[model samples]
Target: MKLETLDALLAARAAKRAVALVTALDGHSEWVVEPGAPPSGLPADLLEAVRQALASDRSGVVEHDGRDWFVQAHNPPLRMLIVGAVHITQALAPMAAMAGYEVTVIDPRRGFAAAERFPGVRVDGDWPDEALERLVPDARTAVVTLTHDPKLDDPALHVALRSEAFYIGCLGSRRTHAARLDRLRNAGFDDADCARLHGPAGLDLGARSPAEIAVSVLAETVRALRRPEG
Candidate 1:
């Protein structure tokens, strides 16, 4: 890799931006391309393949004009932000970490957000909205609210709705979710925006324990991210 190309990749990784490094199979030429940026002299078909590789977050070799090219996708680490710092978070945070997410638990109550309660995980003792604003959830992030309290969960939801986070899940019963939707509607979110939320979070596996519920929520989050059309 050229020093400049390597530097560009490092910079993109630091910024948590998705980019692709394309190299000729002959090992003679290479360039970095960020999605949505100009093609920078690459052929249209090669550019399209680079985009497809980046979108799939997979690195592979593609054939273009009888020449082979290797496309290496450089995507930021996946992130999960949990609001509430409650028991569900206890179960969910580590599971998310094991599933390759950088997890953070947010709660204004220092007692609830104590670092000891969540060793090896980030604990943010800031109000949900403020914490989210500072964290700036991105397309690679997932947000889940385990606190059943409206004062806390509601504010987090408002911020998550405005973010590009791939998934937003909230722990609540169906009736509670309905009421939450009404509140969001009252706050000016339309049905489409509200629809993005996975209320009563988790797949209906009839989970009864915090650990089981965490499994379902993570499964649903994975589904939402991998099968976006579904």
Candidate 2:
């Protein structure tokens, strides 16, 4: 109708808030409503048609005459969990943050697990098992263990393998990983569960320094998260 009304409608759509536009099409005016919004200026039967259009996964463009109305869907945020507060993690946290992960560092040692070390990263100075018990891991969560300690890493790894976490990796040598696998097998973890562990964690990039190792770990983490079924 008016320029200001069109501007407001566009602004609301861009902001991803629910809004509707009524325009004349085929000699009749129709209301184009977002999902969960009531229809206006259109026949009752056409309400279901509008709902189907809004529910579609594809980006929407409702055309009436020479005018077009757009509706956008909002995406959820990403979350990542680091199972250690070691040197590699110091580097990993910042890298994960840059890559849009809501990074969290979990450890029992308060001295090594301070927010000061991680800056903007969320630091949880608690035993991994206990902390994870309180905060259940979800499908969106990515778990990485950098502490070479079995006592700390084992409990966390066990919990992570059982959960729906997209990634579960542990830092160690190949020999160490083999031993870890043996231990997990003894602890009732089947081949399927053992398969989930990315031991000697990080890509096969021959990373030596903690920073380089962090990069490799993050790379592997991304790959694993993107391909959960693999």
Candidate 3:
């Protein structure tokens, strides 16, 4: 345990990369190797401990006091795309951000879609389709529409249905959702594509205020993200 080895270990941890620590418990001076690096002819016990640590979900390996310990790093953050700058979105974006999501707010209206209103969020004032086209959505991304305006919400829904975005939702009443489905059908979206939308978007929590509605929507989004697809 020289200063250089300790520095390398700290550097690997800071970079969010996995590393293994080899120490002498009872053996004589030997070579030490980092995780994912070629291993030297270390003792059988140390080598076996390193192998087990790598095989497990843990990211780090420790050998001291005649024992080996492994520790796993935290998972990567999530990405959330909210397709509206309304009051509900204002509440939702911060909540999602606090919940460890990289929140991005998309609204075509420049007046409503500014950073001042939605502090740390990435605001995009372009049409949802065009904006999302440039920034492709993936399975790690959650997409939600809160405008309740067809002009903005419908196009985003269309794009999300075709993309691999994990969660797609739009806010509206049940009757309004039925009308939206009719329009989507008229626009050539079949039942399968339309089924991707979680309209009246949110859990059936009987939400009344924008903040409460945002919570329900966030809860449903979390469920959709974690649920295994059939």
- lDDT minimum window of 10 residues, candidate 1: 34-43
Task: Tell me the RMSD of model 1 versus the true structure.
Answer: 2.1
Ten-residue stretch with the least lDDT total in model 3: 68-77
Best by TM-score: 1
Which one wins on lDDT? 1
lDDT of 1 by residue, 1-230 (tens): 78999899999988888889989998678879886884668888778877888788889998877889998988888999999999888999999999999999999986998888899999999999999999999999999999999999999999999999999999999999999999999999999999999999999999989899999999999998889887
Instruction: State the TM-score for model 1.
Output: 0.90
Model 2 / residue 220 / CA error / Å: 0.9
Summarize candidate 3's per-residue lDDT along 1-230 as a digit string, tens digits.
Answer: 57786686677655545556655445444333454563656556665666665444345656644665433333224678899999999899999998878888999897899788998789998999888787677766789988888999888888888888878888888999999999999999999888888888999998999999999999998888766362
Angstrom error of the Cα, residue 155, model 1: value is 0.8
Per-model root-mean-square deviation over C-alphas:
2.1, 6.9, 6.4
- Ranked by lDDT, the better of candidates 1 and 2 is 1
lDDT of each: 0.92, 0.76, 0.77
In candidate 1, clashing pairs total: 0
Clashing pairs in 1: none
